[model samples]
Target: MPKLDLGLPSYDSLFSTEEERQESKLEKIVSIPIDKISDFKNHPFHVTMDEDMLKLIDSIKENGILIPALVRPKDDGTYEMISGHRRKFAMSHIGLKEMTVIVRELDDDQATILMVDSNIQRENIYPSERGYAYKMRLEAMKHQGKTIDDFENDIPVEYNKTTSAQVGRKPETADVLGNQLGVSRNQIRRFIRLTYLIEPLQEMVDGRHESEIKIAFNPAVELSFLTTDEQYDLADAIVANDRTPSLAQCQEFKRLSHDGELTTEFIQETLEKEKPNQKEKLSFKMSEIDQYFPKDFTPNRKKDLIIHLLENWARKKSREQER
Candidate 1:
């Protein structure tokens, strides 16, 4: 064999060895321009500019995004952000043009599962957020050929079998998700049901106390079975009357819906019925009552004083009537 002269540069300089290339792929972190990243499709989580977000922005500004975002490269030369939406938003708010991201090769189902799992670890997830997240993850899991029973224990097999029969199907992927999330399977199903709610009603569930009408989770779950049009009708009834459905009223709505008799008029009539909580609750401005109570008085002390005053007034009225 004669020695041959090759004009190519050294292999190490020209291209990485297979092992080195594999190592580089595993070490996927890279700096990508913020504008080059698009949000995950149908991202169920809400990215709000609330107190937590503000704190995150402060931390990132001081610490320079200590954790890198997880993203997937797209065919369009952009990256799809699978997680760290809040971090991205914070970076953008602080005028950062580029962000550190870890790019992973993931299919849609894998990305969805990862997105849900990553965000579900947050402490402030809303009911609606959990609802949509669970639904997405459940679908993804099923698409990946995982079954609900695969995650369930043997103890619940008989019980699940009975319930599954009633529902005319196997225990859904929500059951598997529930096992992972430490929620009861029934509760997981309820949360997934909330995903069917109209946006207004869903927002009511998300913004419960802050919204004009407070919707309890149980009642909201019951209302979720109503058709889209019926849900809109219920929402209108709620806003118009400034009242949310009681559990019993929600049951009535569900019954009507199941019978295919639910209508806007029925929703109004059902909502118009007085609920126990609908009793006129008297509220006084804090400024109006603050003058009568000692400056140092606690709310309990103020309440005691108000009760004593009411008792005295009742006694005086009784005495006047006796005379």
Candidate 2:
């Protein structure tokens, strides 16, 4: 029997070649059946799949997979999907037997990092998604005995790690991934802030109404600064009003416990005060031009009358002088 030429390379050997290093860089590519794939249950991207995802699946059915997914092999002869979850769903929708994959022997942390880097670039992912991904990656890094502090030193300096250097003070691995993903470090910070929100708001973020939640670190921090009940109260108001509380509301939320200053009355008053004002539309009909004046007079008519009288007086004066 002719040997099946899989063209597979050892994970270490894949990175060793001068030519392959320059050309393909990633180790080996293969076609793996979707049935053999397991999920990272703890993944930030593992939110419930929605009907909107079927649209993405439809696109994939028409175009095939534009970008290959990354996967790591398990000892049980199965593959764990690292990224390209949308593609995976789409593939399953179309009944694809196998998907093109870049197979690597990645530890859990490496797999999560690779998955985040893969998807962070594709679209406007919700702030909650990025936040959850960053938070999960931080925990994963911690499990690996890797603090955000030690990440810079872990990678070989010669590996020319693309995003290792740009994280500002108090850098986390998520920050490094943010740089690699071409998003602002502050954006990474904001998403992680969402981690502190209670489950109800987190669920909102996981769904389509994420904008309904004010997700900045200040609001989150101020909200976090509140007691659990207080955060719940404020969050409830946020939901009921279909609007976020103002900075004053945020400040009141922070200072409520100070000698009973923020009361139910205060909250009601603040809501009333902060409720957006209804705007009235004004229109002037062209047919109503004479409403404020005589039959058809305006200030311009008075000016024209003055000009005519002056011209007549000047002509009469000129005629008298000539006579």
Candidate 3:
């Protein structure tokens, strides 16, 4: 009985071509037309003609998309991209008619989870992008049978620890998300809260162009608590003054808004109020200030001259005060 041997191919191996057999063994990859792929609805990540995109296009030209994108078949026969939106753009921009992709049949939630998970791994997601992506994934996770605890209050944040510690409960949504994201649960909640900002303020939070904000995260989160009109007023004030609110100022804004005293004029006035001890800066190009300096002076010599003149002017002022 132990010596008996059957030298026969399996039925599927016997009936199917090697290519067909391989395809049945693994997912089928199709060369899908670029035009047939639809952008994911309300996709959070920005795809700009930035320097990174140029590099991506160059890479595609040199080696092609080493990985096939993931797509879901729509009822109308077009494919909805689940991930690789950037790759899709690069391929289309580089004039590729078709790109290889694996088509799967997924419900909306499954597709959303896959989409978020895949893109969230990228290294340089902007703050706004991270906010919206976290929001979307949280919704998707909830819809897919993960019942997060009811909000302790409005916005469902600021209580991550309590919510995550329910007796006999599965990991809280924030905890799960934080674990996956390598962020603390509280920090994850903070990131999600950024979605409350209006588009203009959110753009500032994302730090683009002259409106780029430094030290805006903590203050911006506080600002998100304001009503829509209040946020707009604050955003307009910020743009008009070219300044982001400091934490203390943002706290006062929140307080005034809650007390029903916040208004456009008030916001503008508050932003105009300079903080104590905040350093003021003035800038001038050498060409602009060169007329004031001898043409033979180097930049360092000019700077030294300015410093010496300021010291002398301060001494003269001191001497006048003694008169």
Best by the lDDT measure: 1
Q: What lDDT tens digits, residue by residue, belong to model 1 across residues 62-99?
A: 88988899999888889999989999999999999999
Superposed by TM-score, candidate 2 places the C-alpha of residue 124 at a distance from the truth, in angstroms, of: 1.7
1 versus 3: better lDDT goes to: 1
Reference-based lDDT, each prediction: 0.84, 0.65, 0.82
Off by over 4 Å in 2: 1-28, 46-55, 141-146, 149-187, 203-207, 210-221, 257-269, 276-323
Which residue pairs in candidate 2 have backbone atoms (N, alpha carbon, C) closer than 3 angstroms, thus clashing?
Answer: 131-191
TM-score of 1: 0.78
Name the candidate that leads on TM-score.
1
The order by descending TM-score is 1, 3, 2
After best superposition, candidate 2 residue 151: deviation in angstroms? 16
lDDT tens per residue, model 3, 91-125: 98989999899987788988888998998888888
Residue-level lDDT tens digits of model 2 in 138-194: 666677776553321113223226855543356566566567667665555556767
Task: Give the clash total for candidate 3.
Answer: 0
Q: For each candidate, what TM-score against the reference? A: 0.78, 0.58, 0.76
